[model samples]
Target: MNKAWEGDQHNLKPLVQLLHFGYHQAMSCIFPVAIFGTLALSSVIQIPFLYRYDAILLILLAVQYLMYRSGLETRDEIKVICIFHVIGLVLEMYKVWMGSWSYPEPGYTKLFGVPLYSGFMYASVASFMCQIWRRLRMDMTGWPGFVSSVLLGGAIYINFFTHHFIPDFRWWLTALVFIVFRKTWIIYRVRITTYRMPLTLAFIIVGFFIWTAENIATFFNGWKYPDQHDSWQLVSFSKISSWFLLVIISVIIVAQLKYVKANRR
Candidate 1:
């Protein structure tokens, strides 16, 4: 038991703590939730003149500005999210061209057959990570050195594109990820007690939730897998591995940024 709960009187401390954890988790998800809501609402509602994709892009821009003005996200965090937006958009364009998945809707805010708002799906993941890192006061221990981590991240990203032409090296890279991060741990606080989890486990957990969200996103017609073109179906469970790897890249970028920011202080 955590020392923070030692003073429990009614034996409800465990339940209370669980609720508190859930509350903070929800708070950390504001951006993704907003994106999901927009996807769901736009699916059924017909805008007078604007295309659904363009409307979603406009709404998300407003949401981003409001989040900044309301102090829900800091300027640095927003910059990180924007960096992820570009990274995700580029991947999206390439993947779509390769016929991995597609945006079936017509929109003025499209480039290379991809809707501009599609990038926000990736940005929302970074938004969740940044929000949770701050909310829980997260810290890392046993992280790999900067150069090594960057090289691994770069390899993981390039493999995503090159794997189409060459033999897939994802499994080999996954092995390297575990080797590199074997000793890493992430410490976070809930109430007055601190807890630590293996960094790789944390990546798996976030990856699973993102996979769940991917199913919902597909249900709402956010994008379509080739198999889902005729009718909606659950995203392949195998994609969890992909999300797991992508989560690693996201964490590495955010972690490096946080490291640099802290050192400058």
Candidate 2:
């Protein structure tokens, strides 16, 4: 009887830990959830005298303000989000011009056929990373030197643009990412226990989830691919590789910012 009780307790312990990990992950995703909720609600509901895209833009602005004022995100984190917003908007303008994907809705906030609120979608990814880093007490081991990390990140960002004109170097960049981060590990805490995950594995995991969210976003008309214009369907699994590279860029920027802040203190 005692042996059975001990076995049950052992099983329950890991289950509890898993639940805790999941709960924290959800909390870290608050910004993303809000953005997704806005996408969904705006799709179904009408705001008089306002376009859907414009309304979404207003709602996201309010949400950002509330998150800052309520202390849900720190000032530094807000800066990070804004930086990513610009980075994302620039990419959006280029991609839309290149006919990669598009905003099908009309909005006053449209610039070069891309909606302003669209940048928030990218910023939300950065928000998640920042929130999770703090909530999980994340750190890195075997981090690469500054120049190598920065050059890799720059290459990844540039490749997003250059791929249209030149040969797509994404596979090459992916290989470099693995080689550069081969020894890097993400150390994070779940409850009282610390866990380690390879940095590359973490990027792939987050990228897959981002790709999943992309499907949901497209279904709600957040944006549409050429294929999705006729009927909604799943985003290509190949895009996961694109997002995998993007996740690396996001992490590198955030990690460097965190390192800078840590050293300043």
Candidate 3:
């Protein structure tokens, strides 16, 4: 043992070590107790009925905003995230209106388990992402936030059978989107450093893991499409191709969004 290392380790006291379990219980409570409370209430009332999922999401977002409020959280951060909420809300609402998928109605709008609020679900996600970026020292500074989201968003959009997000295949063209979008993003948002190559590769690999998780959820939930009208069950080459198709689809969505955003601006 080096003298300096030994001295530093010895300097730690028993009381100081007790801080290790600080916030785990608090966060764990969020999933079961808090979320469950809101969801149950949301689902039970009809005159003010709303999807439990939507209500729980709104609660979480409000909570997240409170958590991430810096002594001086900037207006710009708030603006960017609000835009995310608006865009997501519009996209989902449009899908609903188009009969892409219907949610519990002939013509009912549900928000926060009541009515007239569609954006809160996404506002909550944006706030959580904001908090994560702050902690990771990640740069969500520019188009990276917007561009990265399309791929991630599409993957989330596809697995309606699980989690807060409901999946839709209407925009399957996004499969070829992210690869080219990665190049575009690399050019515009990312400032090149020596570690750029590895960091970019890391992002791609992480995306693959996310895709794998999505595949399992969607596949098990009977949330998949048949190839030539034949269901191959799961765990076959067809399923593997479906995952590959997601990568391609993500790339496409990224590119399409990049184009639209660029041309619009």
Candidate 4:
């Protein structure tokens, strides 16, 4: 440890430690924070001619660029974000088609009733996971066989769509996840101290937070679930299960990248 931080760790007050941890946690969420801030602003403001959604799209793109150019995001992370963007866009297109959700605002940047910037919402989730993983030096142990895990993730993704037409196997998938990741542990650091939690628990915790953000997003009219079409309401807690599965998908992608990069070194 550095001389300054050496005794500092032992003597630090709990409130100070909490504040420090909070700052670091906030740093890991910069992308999500930026996008959410923009959403809050756009909800209340209007431009003369340009659509608010279009302007927000441009702002999000610029933010992505600046994050990269400023060395806050890496080339590999950008690739992951782009992948997430496309995945999100595709899902949004389908969900809007199915009346699962709808974007009510007018925008020139919309495709098939989905605004281009809408994808950034999902990308923001990826950005959060990627940044947090790196910032905390997160690692996993007792991971299930990668091939099986990836296959399970794919099934979970597929079920998201297929459930509308056929039987919903999400609960079963959740069970499988519990089994596969039963022994897996996510290890991360806070300052010089290390902590660990079950990977499945981490997924559930992230899912709950994302569910909270969803409520905020809906309140700002980012998009609306069917229940919100009449009036804004708290998003259903049931949706947390869906977000949990989605987090699994995101984690699988990030973990694969980390694993491959590690092997190359």
| lDDT tens per residue, model 2, 1-265 | 9999999998898999999999989988988999999999999999999999999999999999999999999999999999999999999999999999999889999999999999998999999999999999999999997999999999999999999999999999999999999999999998899999999999999999999999999999999999999999999999999999999999999999999999999
RMSD of 1: 2.7
- The residue-by-residue lDDT of candidate 4 on 55-132, one tens digit each, is 899999999999999999999899999999999899899999999999988899999999999899999989988888
Clashing pairs in 4: none
**What TM-scores do the predictions have?**
0.96, 0.96, 0.41, 0.93
> Lowest summed-lDDT stretch of 10 residues in model 1?
1-10
What RMSD value applies to candidate 4?
A: 3.0
Candidate 2's displacement at residue 45, Å, is 0.6
Write down the RMSD of candidate 3 (Cα, Å): 10.5
Q: What is the lDDT of residue 244 in candidate 2?
A: 99
Model 1 error, position 1 (Å): 22
Instruction: Arrange candidates, best TM-score first.
Output: 2, 1, 4, 3
Worst 10 residues of 3 by lDDT: 186-195
Cα-based lDDT at residue 220, candidate 4 = 89
Ranking of predictions according to lDDT: 2, 1, 4, 3
Per-residue lDDT value at 63 in model 1:
94
The clash count for each model shown is 0, 0, 16, 0
